[model samples]
Target: MAARALKLKPPPARLWISEWPRGAINAARLAGARRRLREVPRGDGRPVLVLPGLFNSDRSNFALRGYLNRLGYRAFPWVLGRNLGARTIGVEGERLFARIAAVAAETGAPVTLIGVSLGGIMARLAAHRRPDLVREVITVSSPFAGDPRATNVWRAFEWLTGERIDDPRVAALREEIARPLPVPATAIWSASDGLVNGRACRIGGERAIEVVSSHVGVQLNPDVLVVIAKVLNGQNADHD
Candidate 1:
């Protein structure tokens, strides 16, 4: 990578080179929703926990959360206020776990986490720490693999957070995802995602659905909502 790239400044117009011919193939699959998407049964018993991206932006997930509710699932938000980078994830786990516990008590069931971007990353940690409470995890546009440099905005994100992009924990996270989760996991990404390298969105040998959505728009995009519904429904059926 160039020193200029490391500075986290704009490259003006760096047309990112696509590495594979899969983008076209992915688009075609998403275009035929009937052919590509299966009829998913409504959930059986678990409630869903929705995590918004870096900015609290829980409101962004309103559409998907509401959809989950309509499908007979109880859905809740992080409720830690806005996602202000106020606390490192390691620090937030206790609170996140508490929220999970509280939600589980309220609904009388285990929970599924649907996370967007950084929230997705948090969901991974939650699932790793508390499998008893988390039945499944589904993320949209979250980069689970090693490096964030693949995404042009990563440097800027680090700068904004005042943290090192290559923090030792970063490497550990990559290694961790290589291990299988106790429960099922699904990742959703898009070729047009201007922020994340869509390829990095894959997690735990699970299905990675390709959706057409802006990096900032996944929470509200109808296509993303549909995929979330399918995964949540599928997970519920597994127990039945």
Candidate 2:
């Protein structure tokens, strides 16, 4: 049977310029509301590994990792440096699987993966291939369920990864990542996202959480943080 491909359009250009300002506002809100985060449920000390978005490095996720750490989870950085699509992680994401395996081995348990933007897509890929090493996956603003061209950053992705959106390998990888994960998965998306289409971020038959955040700053949004904390604390099953 032929593979299923969903073709969704990217977010509007008018929303693109609002990304930075909205992100800044969300960052400020997070800073002021740090105390409220302490009120959220604590984690069970599970290992959680975070992956950065395209053109981003561990630094981009520093705030998120710190928040998870404060909540009692052992949050670790991807440590593979900046994300440049297949160039940094490989076409089959072997490095990402190795990283997940290493964390699982060190912690003596499966690690939950939290990925932002492009990193979320990579997280899903790793979970699909190495479910034994992953406890669960949480994606923020990742467009793993539709046409790669459905993102505003597709051109940038092509330039950085040196792979065309129409490449057969890309198509195959998309199919694999979009498949139902062996382990539990959750998608945190925003219809107001300024990069990828929000519909593409959500997959069928998985828990989906909607937030009013921009694609550029969804990772740092305090609401997103709370939702993630709840999911990790096993308190977000209502969304299922």
Candidate 3:
């Protein structure tokens, strides 16, 4: 049977935590409530372009970018627009591709892409298009096996994104992603991600990792950080 959502019916005592330390049980509600939510392949430290999940803008990724910056890597978010949808698989993709170029031109280094949710798919497509500029792809919750029908939220994706699941444009764009990007890639997902089925996040042709986190909590998850840190450094797996 497929995985089911791990619901948190009882409210947590706390609403927010700046961070979640590693090695702890993947707790959903704390004495205090909080949102909780990682890396490239290990030590390469190339410039990284981060793409936020659906409905998220650069503000959502500022913390992640800051963390990456502190680690001594240059990171950029999509300043061009909020992550609208993959339906723009054609026009918006062109815009996003241009943004990637702009970042590359400014940084003068190959970019390692870190994309979350819908942003994850966009990152993969961008990498596929410009392999030379894209060092590798690191995605969290981006679905590659098309998508799953279990979620009630993806209807929103279909709404905002101009492309329908069967739309010719959407299908055409997916064709490009059929072949995996030439560079190394890692897909991260959680047991509790209700937004997109965790299975959709799988990236073939290399090692993939599964972490324990909610659909919305991955951004604040510390275990996710440890794993993501490994990927950014170019390591496929980590005991850390």
Candidate 4:
């Protein structure tokens, strides 16, 4: 019989108190954007699709997409309005898949997918379903490898998605989602994440980079951006 997946305890409530300060730090990243922009390797104008987390929309990833655009990559948003977990994934996932396919077709090159939090999970599923359309994937603070309920936001996910965490359908889908992607994938996690359990954010046999930031701040954190640039440029030998 297959072994049961281990479930980690959610992060402490006290740690969540640090989330506000982390948001401020991420906001301040804009001040040094130009400096950091020059520090990272420029992209080859390859197509990149950015997906937002749960309860977020394309607008949430505007800053990150803007940064990618400035770095010479053709970054595009998911275009599908706000993410509503299973509601989005169940009904609109085909649309998301079609979007990636369209971008890959237009560019005549496999698209790189960058997903934040729940968005990352969607990215992985997209890659798994259509690896031919994907070049590489980078997940920001996403707990795709472990139990979905391992994060503090699990309750919210259930409430918003209207799917119970332990429901048979959710359980079966979660099992599938936890599988490794067929393409080159990187998981960028934080040690100080306030919403998700960092320990649950790992996939076996893939590159995992640790950054110091909050769950929400990973998108704007300078170090995280640097790591992303390196991964995209194929400059990070460790990930290769």
TM-score per model over all chains: 0.75, 0.96, 0.77, 0.93
**Ranked candidates (TM-score, high to low):** 2, 4, 3, 1
Q: Which ten residues in a row have the lowest lDDT in candidate 1?
A: 1-10
Give the per-residue lDDT of model 2 (tens digit) for 116-213: 99999999999988888899999999998889788888999989878887888888888888888889999999889998899999877899998889
Error of 3 at 137 (Å): 0.4
**lDDT accuracy of residue 12 in candidate 3:** 27
| Candidate 2 residue runs with Cα over 4 Å from true position | 1-3, 237-240
Better of 1 and 2 by lDDT: 2
Per-prediction CA RMSD (Å): 7.4, 1.8, 7.4, 2.3
lDDT of 4 by residue, 202-239 (tens): 76778898888888667877777778888899876232
Decreasing lDDT order of the candidates: 2, 4, 1, 3
What digit string (tens of lDDT, one per residue) describes model 3 on residues 87-147? 3335647777877888888888878888887787788888888877787888886765544
CA lDDT, every model vs. true structure? 0.66, 0.88, 0.64, 0.82
Instruction: Residues 31-143, candidate 1: write the lDDT tens digits.
Output: 46543233556666578899877755667677667667766778887777655342544343688889888998898888899888878877877888899999888888887
Total backbone collisions for each predicted model: 1, 0, 32, 0
Q: Is candidate 1 or candidate 3 better by lDDT?
A: 1
For lDDT, candidate 2 versus 4, the one ahead is 2
